[model samples]
Target: MALIQGQSVDSAVRNALPPRNLGDAERLVSGALGAVVALWAIRRGGLAGGLATLAGAAMIARGTSGYCPVTETLSAKPAERQIARKQGWRSAAAAASSVTIAKPVEDVYRFFRDVANLPRFMRHVESVTVIDETRSHWVVRAPLGRTVEWDATITEDRPNERIGWRSDAGAQVRNIGWIEFRPAPGGRGTEVRAAIAYEPLAGQLGRLVAQLWGEEPGKQAHDDLRRLKQVLETGEVPTPALRRADADAAMPDAA
Candidate 1:
């Protein structure tokens, strides 16, 4: 078991690294191709045009081979994971933040069960639709507040226990998460746990913003729960279930 887990971790590490299989000749060929395109563009157009083509060709080579030399040289070492704690990623931002809700199991379950009720506590979520009994469409506001949409199918729906969901292929913000509701140890309240995994959009801007605004995601989760607890315990209007139904009813049917 130890050996298998070790190999699995190694495999994941290797997959994270850009391929270095290309020989020196291949690297030269890529550079030469970039040069050629740039030269042609310069002759036909100008320096600015030439530079643009050269950049494009360089991107193509790096992307096609999956070996970006720049990334290889600048990439940071992967963080060592604690033997007892296995979560988060060195390459991508990951965290599991949880909060307790002082509510009954059925009320909490009903609140989360309705897709339209998401905006109440889901800060990044813009809209949600119940396409059918276990499937839904979601338009989530991206990290930097851009609108991203995705379709998701609910997996596990154990009443008062847990709810699991995974985004379909077409989802803009691909994610998988489980919301678990467990009775408080002393029967005081319900303990809510959420574990989510996702990969953000691919781009330099996305990477930079993710790194810069790293704490915001976790903070949002915390704030969302605080707000949710307030709404659920206080009978507020921003409940996830109410928000969804309101949005759905407001939309007109297609002509």
Candidate 2:
């Protein structure tokens, strides 16, 4: 949890994505995996096997319910849980990170408020061209030093509040996420939270990469917010050509 002022990004994320149920396909796969583990346990001494089976069942239940007790305790809420059953693919992954900008809540919020400014700080973001008011084209630098391009559209947004989005169909990775900002304790600053749910293209292998990478995604999220703060507070971000275009639009053209 990162606090810009008195706000806790973790707490806002907890409130944004409420717990929900997993997709049918995820429930089915989890049940099957549980059954297999149960069979293996039966062949063994039954005690350890029973424990393993219980654990597996619990995982399946949590996946199906889309609610994990641990997540609840950790101040996280479920945003999306969709099952992609095409070509025998089954996997689940989630990550979150937050950072406090030294600046006030409104300043920090406005910086992130402009999705067009995302690539200025988000390292993994290669390009975010706003094709329209709701849709945009994104080129992402993959975790393993690779690049994949896709389209994303804003699904939900509440100014000075929250922003949420999802990937377009046929994307290399199925991803969804959101950002949240809130007022601080003494009204001195703000809290910022970022949450992402993504399934890589390689199934288990992708999950392995994510785990090995651990919280790199979250760390990057923090970095992006910090840079955003610097840019907003000091106006120091090397303005990109696109940003310049935005600026030009804001100024009047002398005839």
Per-candidate TM equals 0.55, 0.54
Error of 2 at 41 (Å): 33
| Prediction 2 TM-score vs. true | 0.54
lDDT of 2: 0.69
Q: Write the per-residue lDDT of candidate 2 for residues 1-255, one digit (tens) a residue.
A: 335643766668767865654556766776777677767777775679779878777876766567655434333223323333332225545667776565676666676767788888887788888888888888888766788888888899788888899888887777778988877666656778888766665755564464466424456666677776667656765559867888989999899
Candidate with top TM-score is: 1
Report the lDDT tens digits of candidate 1 across residue range 169-252: 766666677888887777767888876655556633454465565524456666677777777887674657988998999999
Give lDDT: candidate 2, residue 144: 68
In candidate 1, list every pair of residues with a backbone clash. Answer: 116-244, 117-240, 117-241
* Runs off by more than 4 Å, candidate 2: 1-89, 210-215, 236-255
